[model samples]
Target chain A: MASNEEILAGLAEIVNEETGLATDAVELDKSFTEDLDIDSISMMTIVVNAEEKFGVRIPDEEVKNLKTVGDAVNFISNAQA
Target chain B: MARKVVITGLGATTPIGGDVPTMWKNALKGVSGAHTLEDEWVAKYDLPVHFAARCSTPALEVLSRVEAKRMDPSTQFGVIAAREAWADSGITEIDHDRLAVAFATGIGGVWTLLDAWDTLREKGPRRVLPMTVPMLMPNGVAAAVSLDLGARAGAHTPVSACASGTEAMHLGLELIRSGKADVVVCGGAEAAIHPMPLAAFSSMQALSRRNDDPEHASRPYDRDRDGFVMGEGAGALVLEAEEHAIARGARIYAELAGTSVTADAYHITAPDPEGLGATRALKAAMFDGRIQAEDVVHVNAHATSTPVGDKPEYTALRAALGAHVDNVAVSATKSQMGHLLGASGAVEAVLTVLAVYERQAPLTINLENQDPEIPLDVVTSARKLPAGDIVALSNSFGFGGHNAVIAVRNV
Candidate 1:
């Protein structure tokens, strides 16, 4: 299983690819909708791409809980374990 | 009095050129945009017709990665052309509520739709991108343009196959005349140069099979012409009310004198051999513009180089103009740039506006032996028009027997 840092890096990469946001700016404290300014459609795209990258199933219902970068990283790390 | 609508700015990302000036210059010089298809799908599928006129410059080169990712290729072309048109119009300030967009597409987001289907089949439903519906919708281009320009008056999409683009212009004219919008961006875009469209069009015998000589494949009015060459691109025009244009000190290209659209109700794929519907559209357009047959000096014919298609357009012209048809200098532009489908009418409208404004008609290349049936004076080379109040017609006919004709008068 990957560590929390690795999951955060992978998720940030997906967000960067989808939203053209700088990977470094996608820190744990940054919110996907507020800080990153990612819309719902883009958020879905990021989630799917993140699922594929991290080899985890990010269910549609679980997407709303991934509000911040840390929330997504923790979920992905826990799911992979 | 009805408000006069004029073409204030023009833009196009065509097979021959990336912008209006370049497209216009190359058209006059008789440049052919058709070439052999380089896609692996051609060899994989072993398609019969293996050539198309793709955009000279890819849309990704101009649009940002994020922007290009969200939009399908068709919407990308439309946005590129619309941005150029908006910038060309030099209108920095306008009430967002008074601006409108009437963009069209014959086949919208084919690439996105097919890709989504492929993803669904291979990777299951979860893999399908969420933007598929928004991108695949026929009005996607119009919506994208509306969002980009903040046009709130209306974002309309008129899907009439190849006549879609010209119909957008017609709708824009009406919008301004009815005092609905002060500025209306009208255009059509098409990017269906995919393996499925190529195969489908080939099956229907609508595409030319001159694989060996792709350059001369689209020879409109030529006796040896077989069929049209498929092309992909977009064309846009910023149309504003005459008084508004003057008050803003905008450079008016020409007056959008009049427009008319009709249906044959005769055939779904084939035009009426008698050309009755097209003839009525032509005559009605002239009447709407208050233009006499003698006043019309040029025509941008909807001659897609198909054997049957070329003759019917001539029949319509002859019926509408009578003997004066012999005097009109006609240019079959598809001969050079190939057929742009829905975007054909809009691009041809831009060319027709330039023809009237510059008093010169672009050449129609590869016409070695003009078909006797189409006895209209086809402009085989750059030709000059009379230096007076002149009017020109840009004709576009689509499948489903739709005919749209627009008249542009010199300002």
Candidate 2:
């Protein structure tokens, strides 16, 4: 019912428990450790769940490629396209 | 030889009671800690297993709404347990660097995560709260405990399925022995009693469904055994180096001599049928303690009520300790306390330490029928050890093929 960007923005509500940042925080840029304070473990779960939810076949290594909310939204958009 | 570590404080939030005194009182009196859930899920979804060993009381009864809103149930239980342990330790002022925390959880922040998902689906994107993530992290308890104690040595968390708490205490021993911390707060917490988790576990055939008689529902090692009953709570201990405890005139509980963990890398849901990992973990703990199997007087076994999970632990203990199996009095505590998941092993370890200190071992409830295949000295009611010196071992194995055992001796 929602656009890919909107879906991603919605999913960001899952929140990174460590830093309390919405994965979709507009300020949440590509750099995780620096900008969002999301550690590798939290990032791992977020990516895996996002991949599953969006049907985006994120590869094992490529999951780390996503750095920002925009990047995740792009991946989801491209996959759904 | 390594520096000795001792338990200076203890805390638990369990079905029988919320604090150590109430839990211990009920535990000693052999009161049943199992009960039915009044949750909306019971009538809404018709869950096959409607009963569980909930905390003896609600969390909000002890913690403020501000604190409750900020933390996941697991972290809140952890904070309550840790607060009790810290208060028990008697020392108010501590060097932030010298103090450390190692609290663990098998399933952390599930409530927060699930609630956030529901919010996202129902309320839309912008309406989701900002604090969902921090409230649900597995390390949330350790972080909160660290913040509370101003601990800077490290806030370590080991998510080894159900064995998480035992491993946490084991890590505390290492932290103190490694000279990285003079005093360490350690334990395990689990609050995964939500409808989804319960239904999921039920679907996996891992939960006991005898809802009518909740108290007798969790029957481990019995012929009528179905599966483990889910429980939620936390347990914690304040561990300090002997030198530090002695300097501060703290009452030493017992010496935590050795601890070791190993991975089975075996199965996803089921334990290794042979329990080879558990065997090695026992060996490692004893060898590290420089103690022999003959010295272990009692054990706290990780005996969840699944059909395939109970016996391997006994077989492994037998293989590792050999004929001394007759001497080892085993207490499958989950029979009474319900399975605390991550908190189970740690809470059992606390019970084990209390047994060693007081010379009294708690009873293994609901063990009506001992599996003929399994061979061990399981305490039926309560066993009083003779007034003599003794050593003990507490074993905890997890879902991800993780096995951890810790050895303790009279201080």
Candidate 3:
């Protein structure tokens, strides 16, 4: 299972690939929509890619709860565990 | 009085060259863009035809990674060409609400659609990208261009197969004449050079099978010609009202005199054998422009190198222009650039505008023996036109019996 730090790094890479945002700027506290400026379409793309990367099932209902990068990274870490 | 429309800027990413200047230069030199296909799918599918005229420069090389990811290849070509056209016009300030786009395509986002289908079959639908719908739509190019230029007046997509591009120009002219928009970015793009289209066109005998001699495969009026070679690219023109262009001190290329569209209503895939629909379109375009046959010094023919297609176009010219057809210098540019499907008309329109502006008709290559039945004054070499005021016609006929013609005049 990926550790919390490793999950954050992997999620950052996927977000960077989809939105062209600098990986360093994708901090755990940054909001995907507000801080990162990722649109809903790109958000879905990132979620799917993140699921594949971490082998986690990120359901549609759970996507809205994971508002910030930290929420996504923790969810992915727990799902992997 | 109707507002006069003029072509203020031109852009193209074609098989022969990536920009208008390079494309025009290569066209003047009669360079053929056709070559054998290099994709692995060719051998894997055991396709009958294995050649196409791909863009000289790949889209990924020009567009940003993020931009290319969201849009389909067809939209990418349109965006590239439209951006060039917008920059070429040198318009730094314009009312966003008064600008418009009339981009067109024959086949839209084929690669994206097929890829999505494959993903659905293998990955059970969850893996399909959310962009598939937007990318696969026929109006995606128009929408993308509209967004790129902040055009709010209107965004239109005319999908008449091969005539789609010319139809877009026709629509652009009307949009300005009707006081709907001050500036309209008009053009067409096509990137259907995929395995399915190749196999489908080959099955219908619409593509040439000159795999060994791909360069000479698209000989428009050659006696031994078989069929057209597929080509992929985009062409764009910035059209503005004459008063608006003059107020901005824009460098006008030529006046977009008139345009007309018609339908064969006879056959779906084949043109009217009697060339009735095409003749009417040609005559109407001239009449709309108030031009006489004698004033028309040149023509950019829609001769796609197909055996049956070349003759009807000649018949239409004869019927429309009467005896004056004998003096008109005709250039079948598909002989050099292959068939760009929907994009053919827009690219040919750009070339026709250049011809009237420079008074030079680009050469039509690979005509060793012209078909005796349809004797035209084909430009076998780079030929000069007469000085003083002159007019040129660019004819584009598409599948589904759609016919479109545009008349351009020296300014």
Instruction: Provide C-alpha RMSD values for all models, in order.
Output: 0.8, 9.1, 0.8
Which portions of model 3 show Cα errors greater than 4 Å?
Answer: none
lDDT of each: 0.93, 0.83, 0.94
Candidate with maximal DockQ? 3
lDDT of predicted model 1: 0.93
lDDT accuracy of residue B392 in candidate 2: 79
lDDT of 2 by residue, B80-155 (tens): 9999989988987778889999999999999999999998899665435566788888899999999988899999
Model 1 per-residue lDDT tens digits across residues B86-181: 999999999999999999999899999999999999999999999999999999999999999999999999999999999999999999999999
Residue B237 lDDT, candidate 2, scale 0-100: 92
Worst 10 contiguous positions by lDDT, candidate 3 chain B: B83-92
Tens-place lDDT per residue, model 3, B51-128, is 999999999999989889999999999999998899999888999899999999999999999999999999978899
Task: Report fnat in order of the candidates.
Answer: 0.77, 0.00, 0.77
Model 2 alpha-carbon drift over 4 Å, by segment: A1-81
What DockQ values do the models have?
A: 0.86, 0.03, 0.88
